[model samples]
Target: MDTSLLFWNNIISTCGVPRIITSDRDPKFTSELWTNLYDMLGTKIPFSMAYHPQKDGLSERMIQTMGISLGDHLNKNLLSIHPTAKDVHDMWKKACEKDAKCIAEAKEYNKQRWDKSHKEPDSKEGDQVLVSILNFNNLKGPKKMRDSFLGHFTIIKLIGKNEVEVRLTKDFSRKHPVFPVILIKPYFQTEEYRFPSSKKNPTAPEIVEVEDSPGPVKRIIKASKIRLNGKDQRQYLVRFKNQTADKDKLLAEDAIPDANLHLRRFRASRRTE
Candidate 1:
């Protein structure tokens, strides 16, 4: 905390206190001390939403530009210090040659290590594959005990040579549809029984088909105010009848016409609280 305050104090001394700050939900930034300090300074701190960093895109791009500019400036300074242009050119050429050699050696080493444990995946567009669950935390139960892979989902298309895009369901909306070849494996169907059963089932349940409307709204779980197109709008986290909590969807207020009564009740309850 002291270190963070000292760093920010130095920045403030140099650039003056900023009117607004945008940051990710890092522990240091979210601490009560940090919040109180900013509150006292009358600076608004708008945190980027979880899993969304594009909110700070401008700052990130600026930092990247500064890094590139600084590197080029340093190189120019080094060239100026050298006795001759030829000497600088030769030094650059040698550096490039060494870099290329190191890169080639690294690639060969990685390839050999990969070959020891993995065969080159033969997946192609339209093939069904199971994706590794290693990167996702949405699954229920202990991580070690849970299934290591999910889906026989179809591949939508090849994304470059190393990654393939899969057609994922709504449950996986938070995750990118593209997965690396290393994290996916070919899915094969189980063989049918060779021997037939002697006895047949006495009863079979009749199947009923129901027309889909927006399924009945179970309840409005929560609400949040968001800015869209330079305007503020309220979005509700809604759970529909027969749907699990994990399947809850975020909908704009206007989209849930059928849930108006529930929305009203929710607002009334919030007011009381």
Candidate 2:
């Protein structure tokens, strides 16, 4: 795509220059060319987390409505074996207009919904904050094993109404420091906060891996252990019934579903046998 021409024709020529632009971290938008273009235009480009389109709620909602409109249009028209060009054009026009209206209504609905759960958060410069790690942590595993947020970052600046520029306390490798306010929460300092790890379960249950099939495999969880990694994410040590000698799998908490339920069932089955 011609970034300059498209920027000029679609954005600049129509609505004039924008102060800031938010977008997904797609390669096209994050490429050097677009970066330079936005820089030249003096537009701050804050990228959403990669693969997390929900971060761009407005655009994602519009796209969802457009998809539904396309499905509706196809259902109503695809059965017809033949149609004239004008007929097709009219049918598409009607569908487009319908989708556009739905999008407008949905936008208003979303704004109301957001207002219910979201208020303008207040943070001054240099305040410590915890940013929700929803978009950043995409690791597949049990919900219990995942971290809900990351940070305790130092706020550098408050941008507009609902965004902030932050500096990482531990890692400086991140390219962009700006993040949305929704993902950020205030971090209160307290003298009572302890740095020590919480007490571990005195009797950790043995966890076994069940084979992924209809047929029963005599797998039992012998033990489970959790530890924190470099990213401060929890990893699990799972030992299964009849596991190979001195061998256990290191997995994420999400790797096992309902560990307690599995263990209970296994014990119950053994009693019956």
Candidate 3:
């Protein structure tokens, strides 16, 4: 699952990664080689990012398909699912392809929907959403983020597409609560919205409370940063305290006690004389 998803994400998201995505820092992304891979492409893999959100429908369908394909080969009790669980994956690919007619139909349906403003990403303030977090600690970045839902926060304001201002409270913050909108994933959460203490919210010029203002419909960005693990890191080359013609010369000199050796030779010559 990890290898396949990485395959899809890496292959599908190749446009210089300005719009980088992670299918949840699924253990596969954390592999040391992945850092070097994304770095070469010029984007930092999110250090404090959440896992890609899972869809129940997709998971259920995939599993059901797998079960049907493996049904005939099973020799276990009904409750145990693929006891080995370790599959060759080429087997999964073949199994998935067996439903050629159904797959073709699904593809055609998706093709018609492509570029047709499918569903808008997500909108409005105060909705609960899944935010992807990454394993920051390992990369000398944010703290260690385990694979889990970290918090349920509220969206306070929307900036241009790809960014938003959010508060991690029913009570909004005065300054630092504002974060970039990319980290938020809109779910069907409506209960978290809290009206500020001020009653004349609309009349206030401060714009502390976000209102559903109509405008040139723009994309929403999250107030908080998406956490991810890898950095577009580069190694620093070693330099000397004083400029030298040859670094290797200093290195070789350190290897043997040249002064001591020379002094011993001179003393032996003096004794012989």
Q: Pick the candidate with the highest TM-score.
A: 1
Model 3 lDDT tens row, 92-111? 88778888878899999888
TM-scores for candidates 1 onward, in order: 0.31, 0.29, 0.21
The best-first sequence of candidates by TM-score reads: 1, 2, 3
Off by over 4 Å in 3: 1-118, 135-145, 169-182, 187-273
Alpha-carbon RMSD of each model: 29.6, 24.0, 34.3
lDDT of 3 at 128: 62
Q: What lDDT score goes with residue 24 in model 3? A: 42
A best-first ranking of the candidates according to their lDDT comes to 1, 2, 3
For model 2, residues 1-273, the per-residue Cα lDDT tens digits are 377767878877889877656666778778976777777767766766634665576776676799998887665455464556448778899999999999999999999999999776888898999887666644467878777877688998989988999997545445468888888888867633443365455797889997552222234444444544644554444555555635555555456556566567756866888
lDDT (Cα, tens digit) per residue for candidate 1, span 28-104: 78888677777667767777654555677677666668999988766656656765755767889999999999999
Once model 3 is optimally superposed onto the true structure by TM-score, how far is the C-alpha of residue 43 displaced, in angstroms?
36
Error of 3 at 226 (Å): 48
Q: Which residue ranges in model 1 land beyond 4 Å of their true spot? A: 1-119, 191-273
